[model samples]
Target: MSFCLETYLQQSDDYEVLINKAGFKDCARLIRFKADEVIYVKPGEVILGVRIIGVPPIPIGIIENEKKLLIPYTKPCHGTSVVELPIDKKEIDNIRKLAI
Candidate 1:
């Protein structure tokens, strides 16, 4: 079964936020998420089960070493943030499937 990103965010507090309320470019810079790891999806691509909202073809970074998911979360009022949250091995595999 596939894990939903939105559901996970709401139901689980196990994740960690590396940065909050920051711009996408900044987040990309900080994490240095490997270019290969970045997944280009539609602005509203439903990852896992979460509708990933961001600029078109948003950049989602993954760090293999830390098993962290680097996502750019955007809101109209606060701008976007680079969030680094820990994910399980299964979830990681699912994310890789979404990348294209």
Candidate 2:
């Protein structure tokens, strides 16, 4: 399926997202968290982590070369504009296995 970054950003925890599909209305809130922090995502929910590139007023691609995922402001005490995962793929895969 095609992805929409605008829709994803609108789903932030502090923000709200609305979509109309098959004559049905779907709504969700956007949630933001720091890298390495744990946030509870409900079942059946689609979670996406997008990397914010460059400063405000200029838009950039979240996918780097269409392969690697980008993360922003991984350090502590940074602004709320963080976009990235602190854990590596191995750790994420291990956690996924554990969940199963």
Candidate 3:
């Protein structure tokens, strides 16, 4: 997939930033607390067009009712952010396949 998270965030307004400029642990905790279901993925997995980085078993939150995904997005200077974005069933399935 050629999806670029930076480009998407810049070009689109379809996503929501739940928590921004926070530490990785804080973001991870938010996902676990807010999400309907949680899935663990290995660090460096390509999710929503970005490679997630952090400790092992990175948390990806799935809100089935909203059809949305919550993920921690990290950048060098910006730290980590929890982004909630709508996703389709196919994409959700694909993400589930990568779960550890």
Best candidate (score: TM-score): 3
**Candidate 1, residue 74: how far the Cα is off, in Å:** 1.8
- Per-residue CA lDDT of model 1 for 1-100, tens digit only, reads 6676666777888776677788777766655544336766676666656777765657777776777777777678887666667766787777667665
Worst 10 residues of 2 by lDDT: 22-31
Candidate 2 shows a clash count of 5
The prediction achieving the highest lDDT against the true structure is 3
The regions of model 2 sitting more than 4 angstroms off are 1-84
Model 1 CA lDDT for position 39? 61
Would you estimate the TM-scores of all the predictions? Answer: 0.67, 0.19, 0.93
* Candidate 1 CA-lDDT value: 0.69
Model 1 ranges with Cα > 4 A deviation: 1-14, 31-36
Model 3 C-alpha lDDT per residue in residues 16-87, reported as the tens digit of each score:
999999999999999999999899999999987778888878999999889999999888999999999888
lDDT of 2 by residue, 35-92 (tens): 1322332233222333323223221112222222222221234332333322345434
Checking candidate 3 for backbone clashes, the offending pairs are none
